[model samples]
Target: MKNITYYLKATFSWFVLPFIVLVLASAAPVKNDVSEKEVIRLGFIPLTDCAPIIMAKELGLFEKYGVNVEVTKEASWANVRDKILTGELDGAHCLFSMPFSVYTGIGGKAGSEMKVAMILNNNGQAITLSKDFCGKVGFKQTGKVASVVAAKLKADKEVTFAMTFPGGTHDVWLRYWLAAANVSQKTAKIITIPPPQMVANMKVGNMDGYCVGEPWNGVAVKQGIGFTEISTQDIWKHHPEKALVVNKKFSETRREDLKNVMKAVLEACKWLDNRANRKRAAEIIGKLPYVNAPADVIEARLMGDYNLGCDQGIEIYRDNYMLFHRNGETNLPRKSHAIWFMAQYMRFDYLKEAPDYNAIADKLILQDLYKEVATSMKIKIPEDDMKPFVIDLDKAKFDPNAPADYLKQVNSINQ
Candidate 1:
């Protein structure tokens, strides 16, 4: 009787244990354990615009807000995407267009996505052309070549242009520049290269041009491998750049913690806008683990001075430099911007047809959450949703209220 009882009890224990373990693994936690057990890991690529995340961590902003944040440096945007999706990172300093691209199967598994918590910074990125084209295209701010050099370059050799990711802001900016310059998409090759590797790739004669954020473009000019063909701001003034994108699961399970994180980052954003602290900000990110460049190289560009290189002289941006907070308008994740990005995907034919713009924006941009954080912090939210805005280089306008009209305009452009 004792042996039978023992055998039955052992079988029940084995079967029940597995079920209990599985339930615990899949179930959500009842109590918030952010400060006690969980440390939110934030990842960033080594670019000048990653300053907000690094500053928030360095200036004790995250700690002050009652959340623990570990800022990790990532090699590429792809790594950032993988880590965020795998739960290795709670959030990241990501491209504004990445979440949209990821949701539509350009950058991630189709229908799977990271959420845009808020905008990080705006208008610091630029398109750099290799030394090969320095003489022909010297800082074309409008980026309108009329195929003067692009066609000739393509005709001479297999001209290649690089961007950081597909369907991302860099890719779009590069594509926009090409289209605006009348370079047929078929005539030139557009490839993906990681941001940091851009200058080196150009150094080794890997690609002819690339669109990337600072201080890589700064590094390229500093290294004498490339020149600033066109800054992204010139392409579209105050265009959206990096974002504070949170993992979907993190957003659901750790709402309060995420808000606190945004509050801290908001403080850092305001700090960055002061401009007086920019040198120190540059010093922080230029450290080995952050941007890993000379503080002077990063500082000059961060302060709105672009040594455009190629004897084109410096292009000083007083109002349109790398802006973390531009009188409170830079941080809001504008729905129209989302619509424009999706339209760009269609414009470049990355998407054969138009995506559901409103639906995707609603899913990705955390509008209500951002507003809550902004209101609590005494920051006024900007009312720029679904508004019509025109880009700098071209007259082609984008009105998010009527996306079809915008699509038709972009569709008419020479691809």
Candidate 2:
């Protein structure tokens, strides 16, 4: 009886132990299918709008999302473009129109397809004139500014203006302001100066005025070297500005990694949009490796407290200030914005002929990818990606469907 009992116990133990092992093995969690990249190298220029990328690195948002990110401070937009194209950098805080220009073959040597993953920020840039023009031209008074330019031209004195990049937001703002005043940008010398250098160049009388992103604009005002003629917001409220961009190959090959990076940046953007966080955000990005500007300089404009430095006194425009993630409005990679940029390029003769606007925008903007990232974050995605918006200049409505007709009606100095 004892032997029979022992045999039965042994048999039960063998069957039960095997079944337990099999159940545990089957229940173990599956390894994540998403490929985790070891390191992501991102490039950025020393401008206030680079806050999203800088804050992401400083706040460990990238690591929080399982991405190891390294932020490189690039010297200029040209350098940023080159690094992205050559894979020296994985991605960059680039001008909104930059990827479009690159993809369309207008920005560099040859056309290399590029992608604008997301918009970094909007409406922080300003058009600043040297102190010499302080009493001569006033804010948003483009007609007076044009008259001054005309007078300078009549006297055989050269009037030079600067923008950060040829087809960049700064260039568009400066050109739009000039054109609105009947001052042909072609008639006035338009030069490209790095944003950080705009103040120094103005002090040395290299340029009469410049349009650039902060804190350089704020720095100029603080240094008493230049004054803000107008904020970019005045030209077009909440205009699309800097973007988070990458090469097409990178976007396609490392899609998961790109999505992770975008998720990190979106979090940073949300953090920055909170007015309570602006002071801290300014402090972080103002560090030596990032913007390298004074915290006060970066914080003021960042919080919508503008001195204008034109003796116009301080003005608080909280609602119309630079925005990062206004409930996802600022970050959406809208195709309409891209269409407007292409329209500008064509209007300025950057493109000899208008390529398929929707096609180019669809190829470059990656709205669907943005939607995927935003949705995963529980951020509300706008139902209509393309909406008709009006610029403050002429109140001319821009219909994404008929960009060509809008271009025809657009008051282009290039024409």
Candidate 3:
């Protein structure tokens, strides 16, 4: 019996113990292996969609994933751009079109670069028409703009509009809406204003209409200063709005850290997409230092509840409000979108000549990095990235393969 017991103990120690150790190792959380205790400084502008980055910090998602993130609130996109270029910021919740716009010279020096690591969210911006055009142009009324603007022109009103930046998403959306409405770009003076200041500028009668991201547009409507002529989703459903843009140095040197940070934000994006968590997100982001807006106002649009002012009533966008992660679809930054934005520059005369579209996209969007992060998280990537896409307002088909032909098909102001 002693001999048999000794034999059994020896076999168990050699085989079963090793098996248990291997099983335990396999079940443990895989370390992402980023260097210890390095704080990743990120930036953001005060907008509702800026939630993912801010929430990553609030929910300890960043820390959970073994990263430290400091999300600074920036004043304007231009300031965001300058800090990014200077490396004062490692990354930011940026405009999806910003790196493209900046690289192509609407607001940046030619040949300078900022890498779009991943997209943050989609479908939350809007073009808000001031109280002056309240009765003239109602919600989703893209057709009435021309006639109303024509009347304004004939009356010597010097029709003007505002966008958040020169070649950002707001500018392109505002331009697309203008062209689609047959309200020629030459007809109105389109100017740039910071997002938070948009309502105040319009309140003093500074502009007739403006295009900007949510919370501010929500603020405008809430204050009776403006009404949403069209939500950007009305312009293009699930259109890319903001991104996780990083400086070139960060992308090249701290690739693993960047991926971990992307993972953290992606987790936060998924959490925000849960629907039940949105009001909690709104309340957190509405605090004085973040968006600094009323939590109720922020929560309304955050939940797709738009109480459009100027007595235009309310618009409830259930599925298409502001998507963070639709099963990891929103995080992939497409080169095709980069190309389309550059082409829009051609259409609106922001570019005098056609840019090397593919080359420019290759320079800006960081798809390979995004794939690495999404794949590790077991998120399936969408395959329709390079395929043709159509906007909600027009029948124009944007073929990524033939951007030039699509350019010609869309009647350009320059043409």
Candidate 4:
């Protein structure tokens, strides 16, 4: 009788424990429904604009949003683009125009659709000329530089300039600056060099000048190899620069994951825009695994303390500095900004004909998604999508409504 009772109790215990375990499992909340932990990988190059993504990971903002993120340091913009295209990386700190170019099949393998979830930064890049061109061409004097290049071409030599990527902000800025001086980009050779390699390439006489983002430009000046001829802000004040881009497939299938990621990055950008945190931010991003430069080298530009380094004295530009979040202005993924970039694509003959500007802008720029994230964060959204504005140097107003006419007015447009 005792043996029979013990057997009965053991059998009853198994059934009761299984039922309780099932109930508890059903009651537990789901943490990340969109993606599994340790699955998402974000790529970034070693530049200042990559700060938000880095900060997001370092500050545990990604974790706060219940998303696991691994930030991968990329070597070049092309690598970043290719990784996104091949699905090796989930997203990256990319050029503002890169996704558009990929969408249009400008420089990628084919027309692989991509999306710009948000603009990463603006007004931090500059045109750095080699020390060799110091005395010959002054800042913003593209005409003199053109004349020098023309003479070089006349002597059966090549005048080469480098940008970070083709159809990128650096390329567009360099081309626009040259065109303003009546120099045809066709007359000179333009090469693509990665940002981190710009200073070293210039040092070896590989290129006459390069247009790239901060720390590299700052690195050039500090190494006495190059000088800043003009900043991108000087080209067009508060012009768009880098963006957070992702594969279109990822965006479509994993919308919630993307939203959470954007929220974390937006929070990071807000933290960076605070002037008081910049010094600490600089130190954090300048470590060997990140920008891999000295904190002071990165901080000077981050704080708007410019040392043009071509016998041009220092200039302080606190208002038009590299801004990540200016009361939510910097975070807006404006369609007008997309239209402007498309206009440049048309200008440079990247597109044989004018694209459906509005359609393309609407498709590639995730403005509505950006708004949702911004609103949830209590950040103000822009009242309108198309804001009419003029670039400071050009003085010609850009109307997103009439991109074709604006392209015609541009002296740089290739006929």
Candidate 5:
């Protein structure tokens, strides 16, 4: 009797298991018509702008949109780009210029193609120097750039500066600052270090200065290793930084899923940008596996309370810091921004020759997708949002339509 009962139970369990799974699956909400079983794998650097991904996961936005999302922390921008190219990453919190570089076959890809879905953050990066140097330069409030560079140049010692990637915003900011001080990068040595390593490297004398994104800059100052020399936003207010990037293949094959992910991220950005929630967001981000730094260190910057760590002291409210949802600024993959990066690439000789500017901008930047996601969520989309915001870094007006010519003009200013 016992043997017969066991056999009957085994047979019944097999029949019921599929039915239960089918019923559970039927109850799941489907967005974008993609099945619940589909999973999205994304990559991000340990920077603050990646808050959207973490916030989206925390708020159940990914689940709401039928995306079983797996967020991975990539070591560097190069790793992020490689993973996207090989389809190892469905998407990434990548540098804004990365897709443009890939599309132009500039840095990593010889012929590989990629695209950016949206701009993630604007202006949460800083150029910081070792504290010893800060004291040596007799840091000044008015003559900030000249005083530091002049003191260092008089010493006739080589100053080693580090940046996050070859053509990234950190690098551009560093170079621009150096040029402003009449310090030729051709004479100075610049190295690529990961963002998280900037502070530690400075402490060990591996680098004299670095240009990196948030938390790390704060980390350096907090640890008493370095002082914030210049915030990148001060150089070019509301500068473009990271983005939602993926291979052109994934963007095409998983178009619906991709759109859904963007929608969820836009919602996350809205939540993160809320003024009342800034403190809570800082606390959340400072925990393990995220920034893992002090809450106060992360808090002040996110809320726009900045300290230079020099005797120059603090900036109470700087409006130029990262604004994920201010007037939906983060969503627009603006053409002018791409043109700026293209010019940077040309200025740095990252490109062997000039690229087809208009075609590359259109192919890489998908403002249409951003608009669709924003409109669906009832977020106000700006009509002239994509208009040009030129930087006088090289003392020239950048033309979005003729980016190559703009590049040449900017380059000529320096020469």
Candidate 6:
């Protein structure tokens, strides 16, 4: 019996000892796949949609996909655009209007061709009026109140409105909303202010109103400096806001790197969209290295819960609340999006000459690259690259290829 017990103990020890050694070996430090590759520098403004870029770094999504990514916080959209254009960044979390503006050369010099790898998000922007204007207009959350404010503004002195940049999502949405309410962009003094500084500017009464991404709008409402007059979703539901922008040069030369970056971003977007992961995401983002806002502030819109604090706060739920990956829908570079932006540019007279509109769009929007990355990740791609979309301001129907035809239909003043 003693011999049998000794033999059993020896056998158990042999198996357990080998298994423990194997486990310890597996627990040894993982050599990051990213370390083998050239670092891909990504630029982003501190907007909520920048989640994907941030997540790619924080969650090791880029490393998982075998790419080294460094995210740099940009001060302004113009700086983000210039960096990507000049190769200061390999790519960026960029404005949706940027690719179109660069393609049409509306905001910058003519023929400044840039490419959009993917649409990062849609409709996380809102137009906030200073508290002074809210009190004057008696802006309320419910009823047909916005029109009343619009009428009052029309009758009274022109109010100064603010947008982050010309030909950016904020400018486009603000213009579209103002036009819908019969308020011309010209009627109000629309000036540029960096989004991060919007709330502070409002506090000082430097601007009467401003359109910007979260948590700035939330910041305004929280501070009682301003009220959210209209969410961009009111202008066009799920309207595209920002995209992954790259210079034409980068797109042409470093095709593989671009594709890899998009793939990692797509994964990050998926991770951000999962409802179960959102609170965790907000907490992660709240860390100083990222947006640095209170987790609740970022989490509010991120969870698609909004308080349009005006006369009082109203709860609004939108599925399009700054989506990164609604089954990867936002990641597609649809031609209709380009067409929509073109119509806005024409409405604002940014596109003086039509430069082979479709040709330029095709060159800049790499739908094919998006397709490859989406497929690799097993995400579905919608059949049509271009879909018919209408802007509410003038009931304008934007055709992807024939933007000039769409432009002709608009009776609004064009410069």
Error of 5 at 174 (Å): 1.1
Q: What TM-score fits each model? A: 0.89, 0.88, 0.89, 0.88, 0.86, 0.87
**What lDDT, from 0 to 1, does candidate 3 have?**
0.86
Deviation in angstroms for 88 in model 6?
A: 1.2
Model 2 Cα lDDT, one tens digit per residue, 1-415: 9999998889878898789889998999765332355778999999999999998988878877778788999999999988998888889999998877777777776467768999888798888888877767775444233445523533556788899877888887887777777766667788998888888899998988899998998899999999888888888888889999997788999999899999999999999998999999899889999888999999999989989886767767878899999898888888988888888888877778887889888878888899999999999887766879899865779999999889888777656
- Over 175-293, each residue of candidate 1 has an lDDT whose tens digit, in order, gives 88788766678777889998989988899988888889999999989889888888888878899999999899999999999999999999999999998999999888999999899
Local lDDT at 47 for model 3: 92
lDDT for every model? 0.87, 0.84, 0.86, 0.84, 0.78, 0.76
Q: Which stretches of candidate 4 lie over 4 Å from their true place?
A: 1-38, 140-156, 413-415
**TM-score (C-alpha) between model 2 and the true structure:** 0.88
Report the error of model 1 at residue 173, Å.
0.4
Error of 1 at 257 (Å): 0.1
Q: Give the C-alpha lDDT of model 4.
A: 0.84
Error of 6 at 98 (Å): 1.0
Candidate 3 vs 4: which has more TM-score: 3
Structure candidate 3, residue pairs in collision:
none
- In candidate 6, position 172 carries an lDDT of 84
> Tens digit of lDDT per residue, candidate 5, span 1-415?
9999998888778887778889999999755433456678999888888888878877888877777788888888889888999999999898888777766666576557768898778888888888876655522356456435523643566778899877777887888787677665676678999887888888899878888989998888788888888777777767778889887888888888898899888888888788788788888877887777788988889988887786668866557777887778667888777777887777766776777767678878888888888888888886654455556343456667667666555533223
Worst 10 residues of 5 by lDDT: 406-415
Q: Which lDDT tens digits does candidate 4 get at residues 59-154? A: 888988988889999998889998998889999999998877767777685457678999888799998887877767765444233445423434
Clash pairs of candidate 6? 96-242
Among these predictions, the greatest lDDT belongs to 1
